[model samples]
Target: MKTLQQSRAIIATAILGVIVSTYALYVEMAAESKPGYKALCDISEYASCSRVLTSEYSKGFGIIPKESALEVPNCIYGTLFYCFMIFLATFDHIGVNRLQLLLSLVSCASSVYLAYLLAFVLHDICLVCISTYFINGLLLWLVYNKNKQLVEKKK
Candidate 1:
């Protein structure tokens, strides 16, 4: 695929990522952290995003801490990750492609793990979280398709 088309798709996907992450962040802040604050995404007791988002797993410093060991909100990290993807897509460099690939892998793995956590560990599902996972899967597909086309063109 041409760089222009791929970049456009990436930009769109990143925008979607931002929207989803922001919604989750809002839920985390307004509903999860606060009592008696019902969030829009909180469909039911079994599908309570507030509950899952407020859990201990919702915050961490990731695999490696660059400067400090301060535990950060997962939604905050996700929002930043999506915004970084927007920056990467806008630049349209080889380095951006590599970074997107790395990001996609982590997104996919984490989504899978979260899904498993919901099914087995948590015993409840978050609709907002599932939507983000679906978005991540879409991003993975878009990146794979774009990279495959590039490889095909090179060969």
Candidate 2:
């Protein structure tokens, strides 16, 4: 059984993830409107918000443009995922274990992919992006730690 404090911590981390992700998405959308703000866009080389956003790489796997909807970046999907995690953490009355495991795997995978973007693809760190990564990493860690307890109990 998880302690109250541990449960609260997980919930807090999940909420943090949602907030950061949402903020990143907001910044990405806001950048599309102003040309001057394009300089802060994610991605390496061109580094221009407008350039990367307009670039083919910004598109989904292939044909889909990242900012096709509401002119918001695809990265917003990450934020949405975090928000789902927050929902699971705060009011998980069904399959709590399964939810935790799913969140742990997704958060871990997200952290790894985002790190790659920061270190290799982006080559530069935006404050909002960095904060999102930090929150994701923290949530992953907490989930992993909590999972360990479950494993121990089963042993």
TM-score of each: 0.86, 0.67
Give the alpha carbon lDDT tens digit for every residue of 1-155 in model 1.
Answer: 67678878877987888888888878778865578888787778898888888776667623335345657777777788788877777654555677788898898899888788877888888988888888888888877777666566667
Point out where model 2 deviates above 4 Å: 38-72, 91-95, 151-155
- lDDT per residue for candidate 2 within 27-82, as digits (tens), equals 55566676556444455543434443343333342246545654445456666666
Clashes of each: 0, 1
The 10 consecutive residues of candidate 2 with the worst lDDT sum are: 53-62
Candidates in order have lDDT scores of 0.77, 0.59
Cα-lDDT of candidate 2: 0.59
Error of model 1, residue 106, in angstroms: 1.1
The TM-score, computed over Cα atoms with residue i paired to residue i, of candidate 1 is 0.86
